[model samples]
Target chain A: MAYALMIHPTDNVAVVTEAVRPGEDVLYEDANGGQVCLKAAGDVPVYHKIALRDIAPGEQVLKYGKTIGVATAPIAKGEHVHCHNIESPERKELI
Target chain B: MEFYGYRRSDGRVGIRNHVLILPASICASDTAEMIARQVNGAVSFHNQVGCSQVPSDMQYALDMMAGLAANPNVYGTIVVAAGCETCQCGMVMDAIAARTNKPLHGLIIQKEGGTIRLIEKAVRLAREMAAEASTLRREKFPVSELILGTECGGSDPTSGIAANPVIGKVSDALVADGGTVILSETTEFIGAESILADRAKDEHVRRRILEIVERYEQHFIRNGENVRLGNPTPGNKEGGLSTLEEKSLGCIHKGGESVIQAVYDYAKPIPTDVKGLVIMDTPGNDASSIAGMLAGGAQIVVFSSGRGTPLGSPIAPVIKITGNDATFRMMEDNIDFNAAPVITEQKKPAQLGEALYKMVLDCCDGKLSKAEALGFTETAVMRACNYV
Candidate 1:
């Protein structure tokens, strides 16, 4: 019910505005006038993102209504999104 | 909207009232500081150059000294010199006179007999100027009277996403209201120069933008460093920025969407009535760049950072904003506003931009920024190395 933020309509993730511990309940608006329960998969800090839906490899990671990066592998909903899975193409090219 | 500010004799408005003690060269710096200490409202910088080689470099120092005096913030100035420096006190005083008819006094250490004698003369003159400055009062001035400077440093990934864009929005708003905004840091515009050129008001301005970037690249080449290989610094890489191009793209966003009006040399005062966004050719060093803008007559500065820095100028107040929420939390004492909400909470950049614009008005009306509160009056004057 707390620490949830909808960053953009096109974004498949919502950022965690404050630190949220693993197993905490994050209630979000669902399509059927019901609250969908999302359990945090790991501790997330402010400005970090959480997967709103199952993301597949190579799928564009949207934030601020733009593609911030592409997911490198399948990420479960509520899992923390960061360098481990989402990597900037520019950085990838540098490697 | 309008804010209360001191109106200068040259028709420019100043956000702060100051009595400036300017050193004509390194030898006069100590005496200038002594004068500032004796006078209640006087401030001086530790100038390290002025007696050097090339005429161009000497002229640069001389122009900056005069520019600082001509800057609207100072009601009057006391020019101190060693009598034989490349930047002579008389030349500096003449430059200030040409710019404004405001009260200006000159003192030469060599001509005045000794350091103690020069200091005594300077302190006496500075006190008279400070008293004269105190009599002047602030009047309501339109927002269009402001010439705002936009600069960013210690950039991280969130800087491109939040802080820069918020400043872009503020730039657009100010331009729409008929104000002038100056965007500098030629090195940061390397990869994105073409995009900005495309936005230029004409072909000449566009070509000049590219020329300035290329000139900076040549400066690096002369120094024996590849521009690309040295950019997107180690800290930037750690913060998720990958290449120089990516950083350049984000950096240009702070200039907003206005058509580029003109480009200028470092520390030269901009032509009044050139309302819109302009660019100044300056190095990427934050302190030097901000100093150039302040000398060029920017009444206030809006500085963005991802890794926060507590930088301010003795004359102009610097408002610090940050994009990274973590950095903001870690360095809350240094940062003035948080733009992380734009990324973390989906707050529109416009909302933060409006807030920053209102804060600028408040700052002009005598509100002290976080940098001012922390007493971070940092200053740096650019110089060239020379051998005798």
Candidate 2:
């Protein structure tokens, strides 16, 4: 089965093991080591991120169990997560 | 726990014994290369900076040049200069002498009448030095004498998950073995300072960790640019890394879980008394960062690259490892090890780390790495500022 990898249980995104076309079902190992399936809502490049859960605008995007970036717009489950929807911020506004 | 290495007069063990044709300035670089080509077991690098600049910038070039010559990997050095450069041959010789009492000689292009004459003289000196270098036999040394430089570049998501973790395991093992490991690239530590500081051995190191990151970011911030705005560079973004934080979190994995014992300035000598993990303030640029570590006396570098790179050091062997299965297969000629099975076959990172550790031992015992075999000796030294 095509798969993605959820690096941490708290991570809202998982990295795709291979490219996924829209509507394709991709499997991912959950934090508990159990496999879960999600249908991709959009295409994602290989090694790119896929939304594991719905994310609202301005909310931090978690990967490696930490804030990798913040969403600039709504990100739906199984949607491709990348620069178009995210911004790597300075965290605390520059002094 | 033991590897065969050349025992230097300075009491340091060297994994390689090449004679170095040192260039004191950019003007002398080609001459150094020309001399190196004629002498077997001689190595030289293209020096981009030497004749320019403010005192601080000139000092960096001087330190790096001397450090490369003083690196235990070389049996001797023949410093070549254009005579009128800011970094004079005599100054470089003094710097090298401050670090090691190894065999040393100097030649000036103007004094020798030009490139051809200088190369002729340097080639003869290098040939004699190479002969002496060849006489040394590899002797057994404990792993504790080794300093491992850890770096990651051309990274993708797979690097953090597989390759860096595998290197992390090796870092931990080397620390456990009482060997020194250098965690460099301060520019990559932006979003993960707290995590690394948490692993510091004491308040001093923890404070230094924060200071170096602040200093690096401020250099950009003071110039009206935010480092976070552009990091996770174009290649990093294409490789699935989204933020400086994500990249940093991955980059820190190369340090394993060892507590940072100390932090050294760029191109400064890594004190021999220090053991375990230390951090060197360096840029994120692969060649420059690796060059800083090598200058600090690292005998070997284990670099993890998910997007793949051919970076190597002239003085030390750089063992390239990749976690991306496709990249490894595609760049088999450049990459030295593959950590892809961690994802493809679900093998443990620790297991792969043991295998990589053995490869490091083999490299130290005189096995040429892919980079060494291909003769990729790209190097760069970090500068304080532009030419004055």
Candidate 3:
């Protein structure tokens, strides 16, 4: 069974369907149905996002195929995506 | 395409037949509650807003009281009032009379001489109403007769991912079949107004969606408060949600993909012809939100939660659902159905939706939900708490 879910082809991140340990490999098919392998950078909790590839600091993060927030620091592929290293610029302004 | 329900004199269908003991003001709530308690087949809610409010807010309370009395779910009603309350019992009775031909009786404590005399009179009226309400029988109604209320509270990540999406699937089906769905909790719409605006059926609807959000924001600004300060609530944060917008996005998922037909004010019934999703301006408080939706004539409510809640309505039957599998196991008595399978088993939303609709039909056919079985009815009216 897939340990992560790629909601859409445009999404650069996938939500961990279950908890993952560091160094575990999860397989996913890309937009074109091409298989892509991702290595877990650290222990990621369930329902949290995992970077599918390298992301630069200050870049936007997409979830539900929409911009959920921007990264606060450089995030390597397979690392856990959460409030610690990202800030929701648009959502914060709404508050 | 049809479910069993009670047909009312007003040409409305109801899932439950209840004799309501309604209070016209806070002071009368105790008397109303006692009257309900003394009579079988009667119900009452804790009235929080009856007096001590700006004229406009008082009108909101009266509207809700009247609407509650006229709700299709109610077979009849007995309204009690503390004579001096600004929102008079007569006004509430008149409002309800304008809407329905149901059996109704109104009483005032001061006019009756004392609390003891009022309670005896209220109990007698409630007993008579309850006896009459008990004679009603369920009848089959077409799918178009249903007005669904969708709500979320104590949200967690799973709310957006599983529970809300499951409700969305149900929403889409009901709307496709020509039924009505009322999407509530305007405060939770913050940071997500544009998303909802994009789904409006017309330019007027789109602007109305935007206008209501702006009006709610103004309420906060006028009070020098930021709604964001309370969002992504402590329970939400503990459940893995990181931002208010994140919460809002997940919250709106319950609307499914239907185009919003129109925006409505609190407690006003939807036009019977408008067959799609509709938004009602209501506070995010679970009980009061349910009250607004019920007052608007929804026969049933499908409330979803991730952190879990036992909130129910005094009139409408609330089918409580949860996406948090852990919470489901933990709060087994409070949650009615589990949508956690959507996340755990990767179950399709449509599958869960079908199960939920079946459950809803069963509920309409007289099956009690966990909340209903536990007698967990609760309700209140919305009031602006901006320190004026």
Rank order (by lDDT, best first): 2, 3, 1
Chain B of candidate 1 versus the native chain B: what TM-score?
0.95
Q: Give the alpha carbon lDDT tens digit for every residue of B1-388 in model 1.
A: 7889999889989988889888888888888888898988888878877777477677667767777888888888888999998888888898888777778889898899999988887888888888888898889988889889999888875777789999999999999988899999887886577778899999889888988888777766777876666666766665655455556766878898899999988888887788899999877778878888887888999999987888888788899999898899999999998999887777988999999899988998999989977767666655443622
Better of 1 and 3 by lDDT: 3
Interface RMSD of each: 7.2, 2.6, 3.5
RMSD (CA, Å), candidate 3 to true, equals 2.5
The whole-model C-alpha lDDT of candidate 3 against the native structure comes to 0.84
Give model 3's DockQ, 2 decimals: 0.34
Instruction: Kindly list the per-residue Cα lDDT of model 3 for residues B67-166, writing each as its tens digit.
Output: 8888888999988999988788888889889889999999999999988899998888888887787888777888889999999999987888899999
Classify candidate 3 by CAPRI docking class: acceptable
lDDT score for residue A58 of model 2: 92
Clashing pairs in 3: none
- Cα displacement (Å) at residue B326, model 2: 0.5
User: DockQ of each model against the real complex?
Assistant: 0.08, 0.58, 0.34
